[model samples]
Each structure stands twice: as C-alpha cells, then as structure tokens.
Target: MRLMGLDYGDKTIGVAISDELGWTAQGVETIRRTNRKADMKRLGELIREHQVEEIVVGLPKNMNGTIGPRGELSMEFAEQLQNTFKLPVHLWDERLTSIAAERTLLEADVSRKKRKQVIDKMAAMLILQGYMDSKKRR
Candidate 1:
C-alpha cells in the first residue's frame, strides 16, 4: 500500500510519499498552513492523487523521549488526519530528522536560500526514510 509522510510545523507542513512498492520515499511539496479545514482538504486531495492508503506522521519527541508541545501538536494532527481522511495514521518518532536533513543539505552544498525553500520537504523525506528503513529491517 502506498504511504504518505508528513512533517507538521506551525506555519507549514512537509509532505513525502513512498514508492508504489513502499520501498523508498521521495519528497513531495510543502503545504502552507492555513486553517485545519483547509489543510485537511488539501491533504485529502493529495491522498487521492497519490492513492495513499496509510499516513505516517512525524511525531516530534524530546531528546529524552518525552512528548513535548510539538509532539502533542503532531498527535492532534494525526487525529485530525484519521478523522478527515478515514485512513490509518502512524505516528513515528521524529527526533533529529530536521537536524539530519539540514546536515545532508549542507553536505550537498545546497545554497542557503534553496535549503530554506526545501528544508521542510527534506525533513519529511528523512521522517519517511527512517520509517521505511525500520520496516525493511523487520
């Protein structure tokens, strides 16, 4: 089944999609945060377009494994996603995914401005990649 990954932020949402075979993930687009209804509507459209059967949302956990404010927000988003899209939403620990993405972009010599434009998407890819790798290990 195809899976969609999300990195939810206060002002934007990073999106990613797994391959048809669910073996790899590719960065999609960053959705600008508007309102909950609008955001879910856009996500629903993407879900239909990608034929997404499941969603894996990045759950921002503190380094010590406690659920912080960001983690709570992510859980709320996951709940809304489940209710709005009627699909299974898996919350994956996303500690350091953004940091990892930033490091990768820096190593790639991505321009600062370009990195700013795509950082969220890259973070989403990192989240999804971790989930995919874990699945493969199992």
Candidate 2:
C-alpha cells in the first residue's frame, strides 16, 4: 500500500508519497496552509489521487528527545488526519531532517531561493524514506 509523508509547519505542509510498492518515497507538492478545513480538504484530495493507505507525519522532537510545543502540534495534526481519513498515521522522529535537507541542497549548489522553495518537500521525502528503510530492516 502506498504511504503519504508530511512535514507539517505553521504556514505550510510538505508532502511526499511512497511508490505503489512502498519501496521508495518521492517529493510531492508543498501545501500552503490556509486553515484546518482547507488543509484537510487538500490532503483528502491528494490521498485519493495517490491511493495512499497510510500516513507518516514528521514529529519534530527536541535534541533531548522531548516533545515540545511543535511536537504536540504535530501529534494533534496526526490525530486529525487519522480521524478524517480513517487511515493509520505514524509519527516518525524528525529531529534534523530539515537541517540535513538544507545541507544536501548546499552540497548540490542549489540557489538559496530555490532551496527555500523545495526544502520542506525534500525533508518530507527524507522522513518517508527513513521510515521505509527502517521497515525494511525489520
């Protein structure tokens, strides 16, 4: 079953989708969050379009592994997603995914403007790919 990955932020949500075989994750669009209802509507559309069976949401934990306010927000979002879509939602620890994504873009010599546009999407892909890789190891 295909899985959807999300890196939820205050202003936007980065989206990624797993391949049909659930072997790889690809970066999708970044949704600008207008409101909860609108965000849910857009997510529902993407879910249906991609035939997503599950969702993996990045949970931003502190370096000390503590769930701070942002982490709480992610948990709430995950709960909403599960209730709305009736699909399993998994929270994966996403401590430094964004930093790693930025470093990757820098290594590739991506322009700052371009990097800002796609950083979240790249982070989402990394989150989903990490989850998939962990599953494979089990």
Best by TM-score: 2
lDDT of 1: 0.93
- Give the per-residue lDDT digits (tens) of candidate 2, residues 71-104: 9999999999999999999999999999999999
TM-score of 1: 0.97
Q: Which regions of candidate 2 are displaced past 4 Å?
A: none
TM-score for all models, in order of appearance: 0.97, 0.98
Residue 73 lDDT, candidate 2, scale 0-100: 100
lDDT, each prediction: 0.93, 0.97
Best by lDDT: 2
lDDT of 1 by residue, 1-138 (tens): 889999999999999999999998999999999998899889999999999999999999998999998899999999989988899999999999999899999999999999988999989888988898898999
> Residue 56 in candidate 2 has what lDDT?
100
List the RMSD of every prediction in angstroms. 0.7, 0.5
Clash counts for all predictions: 0, 0
